[model samples]
Target: MTTILVTGGTGTLGRLVTERLRADGHEVRVLSRHSWPYAVDLREGTGLAAAVAGVDTVVHCATNPRGGDEQAARHLIEAARRAGVRHLVYISIVGVDQVPLGYYRTKLTVERLIEESGLGWTVLRTTQFHDLVLQVLQGSAKLPVMLLPAGVADQPIEAAEVATYLAELATRAPAGRVPDMGGPEVRTFPELAGAYLRASGRRRPLLNVRLAGKTYHSFRAGGHLTPERAVGKVTFEQFLTGRFPARG
Candidate 1:
């Protein structure tokens, strides 16, 4: 019964990780901003020491994708070290090193911190989640016509699958930088958007617009894809069907 502290325990992946760890009979503490039992903010370094103390491992699922991820990771690493944490498991996105996106850059920086922190650590880089992909599609569908970046491909995995893997990593002895995990299949943005529209019973026209920038170029080059590591079982179509069975 190892005691583990899971940061961002209320978020999408974190919540699933917490549930899986608890189901395995481990003592799990959840750190969130307003949640009970444990309340901690990684960005401000508040309530971190208390949440980390006496924990056997720290699973870092918390992230600020918009900005400030590096500072938050630094604070968490320092707190974990002070608490003498046995292991720190971090969840990162696939292709953080290869992608030129700002969020990916921040994740890469956090990976470096964990590597040089001298603490027992494991970093699992996974592809984007189905939930995130759906959110993006839903947001874009609001336009007059659904517009997608040409040649951009995504390998989106289920959040629950990633959560289960994270729990496995947290229990085992720390292994630095595990192999990347990706969805079972890779699809273009237009394909994904069309699937979403069909699943939602909306017949929105999709226009593939060629985007110009390093970000889109990297995506077009498959920097965000790990074809060899497509280990997830769920596909976008399956996810849509599962989520919107009536529409399907």
Candidate 2:
């Protein structure tokens, strides 16, 4: 049986990946900073060798939005090299190379680091997660008028769907930079916001706020979208329905 280690194994996506791998009869090791036994902080590099020891593949689902991801990856690569790991699977956002946002830039950087690493690797870039869209709607729920980026759009896929693909990737031979994964539909922010409002049974006026910046411009231009690769199964609306059941 293939032994795989998933970094950030406690998170939403990572948890699902671990489950799928185990269900397929592969040995799975979960590593998180506070998790017991395999608790290894990728940022610190300590305990990672033990965490990655003897693993056949590593599904790197861990990330730091605040910063320090490069250092974490450096530590991870070093440990994986020492462990003689066969494959390294990475989860990245679509348009990382095109987007100028700091986080996107960092993701692109990590992708490069992995590609250059001697160990076999696979990188999957997908659109935003449905969870992120839901979080945005929730964050703006208390406001009388929902404010969304005027020209931005989202093609959000279900995290579980992503996890399924990642699990499959882990079992197969490493394929570098697989096809981009996008949600089934390319929807405008206001349209998605309306969907969220309808699902929550709340009526709030939607306001489109245009911000000044290259980042927003890139978003407006659909730099983050992947219309050509809309392979995701669950639509954002479907995901919302699951979160908020309809009332009779």
lDDT of each: 0.92, 0.94
- On the 0 to 100 scale, the lDDT of residue 55 in model 2 is 92
Count backbone clashes in candidate 1. Answer: 0
Residue runs of model 2 more than 4 Å from their true location after superposition = none
| Model 1 worst lDDT window (10 residues) | 33-42
Error of 2 at 23 (Å): 0.5
TM-score of 2: 0.98
Q: What digit string (tens of lDDT, one per residue) describes model 1 on residues 1-248?
A: 99999988999999999999999999999998877767766789888888888999999998877887788888998998999999999999998999899989989999999999989999999999999999999998888898888889999999889999999999999999999999999998988998998899987888999988898899999998999999999999999999899987
Weakest lDDT window of 10 consecutive positions for candidate 2: 239-248
Q: Could you tell me every candidate's TM-score relative to the true structure?
A: 0.98, 0.98
Q: Give the Cα error of residue 14 in candidate 2, in Å.
A: 0.2
